[model samples]
Target: MFVSRKSIWGHTGKVMALALTLALNGACGDDDDDEGGGDNKPGDSVKVTGKVTYDFVPAVYSTATRAGTLAFSQVTKKPVRGAVIQVRQGNTILSNATTDDQGNYEITYKVPSSGSLTIVALAKTTTPSIQVEDNTDGDAVWGVGTSLPSNAKTRDMHAGHGWTGGAYNAEQRFAAPFAILDSMYTAARAFMNVRPVQFPELKVNWSPNNVPGAGEKDDGNIGTSHFSPSDNEIYILGKDGVDTDEFDSHVIVHEWGHYFESNLSRSDSPGGPHGAGDVLDPRLSFGEGYGNALAAIILPESMYVDTVWSQRTGALAAFGFDAETAPSPSDDPEPGVFSESSVMRILYDLYDSGSNESAYDNVSFGLGTFYDVLTGPQKATDALTTLGSFVNGLKAQSGVNTSAVHALLAHYRVGAVTSDFGDGDTSLRAIYTPVASVPYNTNVTLTGGVEANKRQQNQYFVFTGTGRTMNISVSNLSEDVDVEVYRRGTVVAAGYLSGTSPESVTFSSQANTQYVLVVTGYKEADGVYGASVSITSP
Candidate 1:
């Protein structure tokens, strides 16, 4: 009930009150000079925070990358400053920085050619501030690039001279639309019902100075700069940092596609990369093809822009691939660079072909569908299950215990090859016997018209460690055929006979090894069929 007045207290009383509040926030030290620590040593704990920015003009068609500074306040829920922040990409490391009292900061970092990257900031009172558990924020900071700008978090930005663009040209392009190379993950989570922690570190970075003829100051190691090795960080080669033409069409999408493929493969099988290929042969091609396809998928009505290169559609179009009527690139009489699918080229064909009419069914167009021959579900609803089917098939072929799939996934995944194939032992996927012996006088039928006895698919091989020479032949069949060698489902090799006239193949094999041969008919049937292999000790 007592009334309070606004009148000031005594000078001494007021001074005393001011000192108390200063000490509480550590804004002002005690009367003792020692309290300052000379402004060098760590001061009273201050809550630190920060926000990261990446910009690429999404509305435009050029390859200009720009960035902005996002202070802690902008982040809405800022992190505790005064602590260390680390960013990463896959297993690569990028940077470590500390936030100031205002809870804002920025640090330089390296960015990889292409792929999804993540950045992380950890706050802890102790020396080892960060550990396995990192920042939960996805759009925190990118050592390179990880997302595209949207109306929600994007702005027409200018960082410096020659860096004119918004947040959609470079890495920012993926930010708003798909979470920067996160299409598979989004689809996986919604459709597969799994929320496995797939990403670990973070990578963040960007550059706007890169233009066709305008030179840039920084071009990373091997003309390829990258940072954020940990799974938590991400990086983007600034538009000014690399050639927009090649980088955007060939490099960026290609590399990111690898990550998506790796992740999907991981979820599908216990084995990672190695298993993925064996289990999902089409997936590998499809995965790589998908990357190339993204350019078309995103633009839908545009072509790649490489200031200096030939302004033309992808190779798939020039070659005129026909999925329904023409033979696959595999069937090309004299295939050169046609062996591998240029994702860009393939995707362009997809767009030109239109959505309702997936040109994939035609072998002539080099357009094909993994789902059509996959014998499983499509990517939208059952990615995990669909991938598992691929893994199970590969595992069954590898002749290894299915339980060991996880261990294999870990093993090869750590190496250059990610052993995460859903398939078992890939050895059975195909066999390559350099040397073997069979009576060439009578051909083994590859057209599939003759039974095992009628064609003699099984043959004999005598091996010498030094590598032996051998040849094969098939009766009357005119078309060249492919054959896979196996050991209890382990693939020894998978290939076609380079020569056709005599219907024969020459090869060398490992010494003291017993090999089994399985013949596959050519894609098309030539009717007359017969074939056999022969191995001669050197």
Candidate 2:
């Protein structure tokens, strides 16, 4: 725990002062020994006060192109709130402080008369547990240090943008880490406003060398700005010539939303590459759409912008969109529950008070409504977290306007979702077939959509375990198949052999427990597959 010296002084300053006086008297033999020590007495303490600010580059969007550009001339100094401030003399830390809302902090500690001190502002916090580090440098925490005044004088620290005549200097890119931390701080504060939440530790990795390519992360090839659930860390792209996202608050908060879902809510998305105008898997659609909407809600504006640099002209450019409006039919031909754009529009409409042109969005339930559904029902729903499940959970809330929700769903080509399993939609009603008897066999057709993990690549089934060993298998003669058994939101057994016609798994089950089975075509190929379930007695 990072304890603030201000609190300690406020609570026990008298006792600490008495103890220090007694120790100083014992060490010096008598008070007369330090009489000629001038203003630097043995028990004398210096008060250090300062403010931390960072240069923020805002994105200016063009209405005609629907994109943005970095307005370097309009850079403003913003407060670096809730960051750790440390005063150290060589290798020993003298005192600690935390910046308040106005970016101001104060620390008082005994300072030696001869040694110089350095004050550092770290991009970290203990209450919400967020840290920013440069992955290229042994994962060292990013900070800026300056010499502290020897006397009780005021000092300040500013992180500049490192912008020069035509480009950014890599050596002076001190504002990148703090920019990412500020965005995450805004996101965490928004959630805490709705409800008191203790967020898990989240580390954000950013470096000037982090480029956009698939390779080793430590070597600065970070593929893209995304959240890795396997490591529970977020990697932001900071390669200057290719793409840089440290100043893009929406991009940072969007990835933070994925972290929120992984820890706070629930997500069953089999992570993949997805973008606008693509018909995605329902799980991916919901997850991505929720991320987009949550970022808009947390930030001050609804426009999402991501800045990039053009290699051809060496000019900065950006890709942006409005989360509050619906995309044109030409841009998004298939707007439905399987579309991320539709999901984002629907969710933003539900929370925003402004009138929407796309639908009859008269519902403004605020963040508290969405918070209740996400942390309560949506996290515990039996079905996968999708648009249908979210809508069902929203309608089940105490005083939600179901009529408006139905209207919004209808506008997106989705009817009233009756259950978490999507019973209202005919195409999804038969998704989860229940097996009542032993030796159950079913023939299912797997259709390859425009891409893998979209719509028809998998089939689901459910059954009740009899406290005995069971064999679950899937076989396809011409294509590879995989099978998995899950109980209570976790996979108990799985078989995913490559290039094999049949995949099987055997596991002992508990009595009177519900189990789910999923059979999929390897790589989401188009084929006819056979799935079977049978119990083996002891």
lDDT of 1 by residue, 229-302 (tens): 22422233333323322123222433443444443322111111321112222323334334444434433324
Q: Can you give the TM-score per candidate against the true fold?
A: 0.31, 0.87
Q: Single out the weakest 10-residue window by summed lDDT for candidate 2.
A: 1-10
Model 2 scores a TM of 0.87
Clashing pairs for predicted structure model 2, backbone only: none
What CA RMSD would candidate 1 show?
20.0
lDDT of each: 0.30, 0.75
How far off is residue 139 in model 2, in Å? Answer: 1.5
Residue runs of model 1 more than 4 Å from their true location after superposition: 1-41, 59-242, 245-254, 266-285, 292-538
Per-candidate RMSD, Å? 20.0, 8.4
